[model samples]
Target: MTAADFAGTKTALALASSDVTMREAFVETVTAAMDTDPRIAVVTADISAGNFAEARSRHPERVVNVGIREQAMIGVAGGMALTGLRPVAHSYAPFLIERPFEQIKLDLGHQDVGAVLVSIGASYDDPVWGRTHQAPGDVALIDTLPGWTIHVPGHQDEVRALLSTALAGDDRVYLRLSTRRNSRAHSVEGFTAVRTGSKGVVVAVGPMLDSVLAATSTVDVTVLYAATVRPFDHAGLRAAVGSNANVVLVEPYLRGTSAHKVATALADVPHRLLALGVGREEEVRAYGTAEQHDVVHGLDTAGLHHSITHFLG
Candidate 1:
């Protein structure tokens, strides 16, 4: 599928190797959750209707559309949460997190209330939209707010697992969906070891796993896959470390968002670190396909391999 396919309307399942888009899994999970529990609700900020037609038709009362008002969308979800209802709010990452940051901070964070803040277009999911739509700082912003569980699901099945877990809880949670997806589904919680090697370890967050594996195909390094990274699986990370103790964090979001956690996780052990992700030094004003952005940012497999080689060597 092309970048346009992901940016366009969400439709029937288009499975590649038995894997689906994270958004599809989200709609299915939320729809099913709402079916079993009346307290659950979904709020969208003027997104496409094709993706959520089933939920809108089946439970019009529970599914809300606040129009272009991204901030108001969060406020509405916050209000709903205060009144004994579980609200799940969504939009493109920028509209969801950047535009409505205040509402998320005050309306929900301050009130000590919780809602499931799901967003698509992670980082440069739709690179053609340019910086106005790109959001590499979404997770970083959420990091500032305490007590928020962040789930960066790599596959649709993982999206289902994480979304279901988020809805089942009352704590504030942010589920980040993206055009980038992993071919494999990791249903297990926490961090799962994808490969083991004697020369240090690499941590791949969400959709970065597939590229990471391809990048490190010839390298001797253990790879740890994280579907849910908020709580940062310290134990699994510690366990994944090998004799080299050199670490590389391959996150799909901002570079070094988890650098602190990684450093702290292996503080006792001597380790060198290289954090990789979208750069924040300047705006990538250019617009094209997601691959174009990845190429520019050195996120493609070749680039990843180069970075890993330099870091490990």
Candidate 2:
């Protein structure tokens, strides 16, 4: 449960070339979908130009740019939704979620209308951008409003599946994309089992699977992989945990956001739970690569292994 336990481990590893980034897959999938469905409109706060260039060129009228105004971006999306158009809004994590919290609450939540709120910065995606652009609380904030289905896809394949599914629905959907990703792509929905153990269970949400695997490789615990956290697979979790009430949740967002659901699922059973994720106690303020931020926040394999080992004991 200490640094010595992870002594010779290579914590930071790269993905294969075949793997597609979540951002790339989402833009490509959505743009292609626009040709068949004219009801799909894209609204951006000026951050996703690289991905939207093709969509902008082909369907200029369908794409709306609200400059750098995050609030206006949501407002515009809400308006379009009312007119029978399904709007997909995009921006940095904080600018999209925190800056326009009220707009999302009033324009989207209050009106009972919905938009596909997609974002790139998952917590500290841009450690170089510092705290202003980071949003570890986006999911927690979204949980404030009821009926929002949140998708935290770990790979490009999952992104494509979730985006297609969300676009077809009329309810509020938040697709959280991150620079942090898993080594491989998982199935579209539900929890996938990576390993099994009898002592307890560990649930790795989206991009957290790789690190969770590295952390629990030697530990005796069932590992469950989830690409969709909200609308949390309560049944899947309860089934995986079975008689073992000891559970560990590793997510890429604010810690303990789904703690309540886990508790609710195991309410009748006596349980002890540990929640690991990005810390919200203080600002990171460090300027470096995203990996460095992972180290500081204990999301890396070494850190995660250390935490899990201690928690299980």
Please give the CA lDDT of all the candidate structures.
Answer: 0.87, 0.87
Candidate 1 local lDDT, 163-282, one digit each (tens): 888899899999999878887787548889899888878999999999999999999989999988789888888878844678999999999999999988888888899999988788
Model 2 Cα displacement at 255 (Å)? 1.2
Worst 10 residues of 1 by lDDT: 9-18
Q: After best superposition, candidate 2 residue 89: deviation in angstroms?
A: 0.3
Evaluated against the true structure, the overall lDDT of model 1 is: 0.87
lDDT by residue for model 2 over 65-152, one digit each (tens)? 8898989999999999999899999998899999999999999999999789999988888877778988999999999898899999
Off by over 4 Å in 1: 1-19
Error of 1 at 106 (Å): 1.1
Clashes of each: 0, 0
Task: Compute the lDDT of residue 187 as modeled in candidate 1.
Answer: 51
